[model samples]
Target: QRGECCSIDHSAKLAIPIMVAKSDGAINQLCQPGKKRRRAITRGQDEESQKASSSRRVTHSSVRSDGGEESFKWILSKRQFTDDATKQVIDGRHCIWSRRRQRIGEFDEFWTKSGKSWEDLTTVKDPETVISNFIAQQISVHATNANSNACRTAVGMLFRIQGFHEERINGFALKQIMKKTSCNYKEEEKGRTNLQVRNPSEAHTGKS
Candidate 1:
């Protein structure tokens, strides 16, 4: 061991730097370039996604299936109306109406197909014209004349609560649809009555 030059192990120096780096928390920074910038980028993506989710303005809709009424809540945006008085029309507005008579989705389609909704029925400047279109659309779906009339009545009630009067007891288009349906019903009834009278034997035997 005299000429062995003290046998100093060079490998031990490599292990010392690694240990120091770990203690100082610089190993991560050294092995990964731009570690701080990468973390900042990740934060940026998360913030961007958060902002997008926050800015999404979709309206929420929920309806019960139990053939019972459900509460409707709409938070009035302060800036949506020009004055507090107008805003009062929407703040805490609640309505409990029959929702099981007809599918609200079909009714919603009736509005969406006509460029409106139950919520926006009174918001439009020309509800008469819009409703005329809506009624016609309903009839086009082959909805029974009575059902079409009922929908118009429902919208009129919604309007009244929003401080609007019925444009007319029955709008022009609605009156026409009702009249046409009424005439058809009368004719059908008359035919059935005549048939029943012609076959009294069949009626007595319950075979008609």
Candidate 2:
């Protein structure tokens, strides 16, 4: 009777270790290859569970969730300066000069032809004041069309004088013109096309 009880107690201890081993095996299959080798071994393990866990592990490593790299590339490719803004940078000085010259010419014609001496006009200390006053009066007649076109032309001339690439200048101008005229549709279509052209891989991934 004592021998029978001893045999049963030994079997009970071995059964506990077997259950522990099974639990370790279940956890091991979820771990990577290097990690799996470190886990405890087990008997009576479920083959299906091991296969499922292995598949999941492979999927996790193979699939990328973050689109950050593609997004950054897209943004960089889409970055561009508008024509008006570029024109402002390039031709601002010339535009100012032209406006001042036109004002001086008008002043000379008006005062000199009316019997005032050229010396008297030249003696005026503040040319800016005279130009400002004259511009205020002309603002009503030709402010919109004249100012905009003159500024654009000045910008174009500046770009040419500075030896900027014509293609780049035209592209910048085109973007500005489209933005100004289309407002919604052109911008949206441009954004879509830019994304398509820049990120063909991303589009393919989405389609699949």
Candidate 3:
């Protein structure tokens, strides 16, 4: 009877006799008058319920998402440092930040010794502070050397890189840098005009 039931596809509807015959063992055991059969049925139901509950708990607690769970497990397994090592790294000052400062200082000292055009150290004494100020100065100098309009454009680019998409540098600050750099606005304008005049015919042809 069990073999016949196993052979039949579940999708195909079977007659009552066939269903009864297939499940005869389970039905007889369950319906027997003795308390043993009753106990067996109850135990089977309890076991099934426990299995379902266990599965639910596991699924609920486990990290889900196709590749995410596997990736997380991989990362966790690859970590070499124990809890103590992690605590030491976190609590100690001899880490990445200190190493970065040392590297920057070495570079700055080398440039100073070589008499190369380095950032002014008189204004910013701290290594970290000097790093930021130096970058700002370099950018300002580049902007000034490029052209009169370059300063404003450079400031816009700086703001975008710093994650401020909408903010712009004030006109006064830009004017101050331009003045300090001694970039001659009038000379640049005159040069542009001279170039335009020299190639007026070529410019007109290209435009058309």
Please report the candidate that would top TM-score against the real structure: 1
The segments of candidate 3 whose C-alpha lies over 4 angstroms from its true place after superposition are 1-152, 161-168, 179-183, 188-208
Question: Arrange candidates by TM-score, highest first: which order?
Answer: 1, 2, 3
CA RMSD, predictions in order:
18.3, 24.6, 24.4
Per-model TM-score, in order, reads: 0.43, 0.20, 0.19
Q: lDDT: which is higher, 2 or 3?
A: 2
Global CA lDDT computed for model 2: 0.47
lDDT of 1 by residue, 3-82 (tens): 45334445566779889878778757675778777998999999999887766622122332111111111212312444
TM-score of 2: 0.20
- Model 2 clash count equals 0
Per residue, candidate 2 scores C-alpha lDDT tens digits across 18-39 of 9999989977866667555545
Query: Considering every candidate listed, which one attains the maximal lDDT?
Result: 1
Residue 92, model 2: lDDT of: 57
Give the Cα lDDT of each candidate. Answer: 0.53, 0.47, 0.45
Model 3, position 122, has a per-residue lDDT of: 24
User: What C-alpha lDDT, on a 0 to 100 scale, does residue 12 get in candidate 3?
Assistant: 50
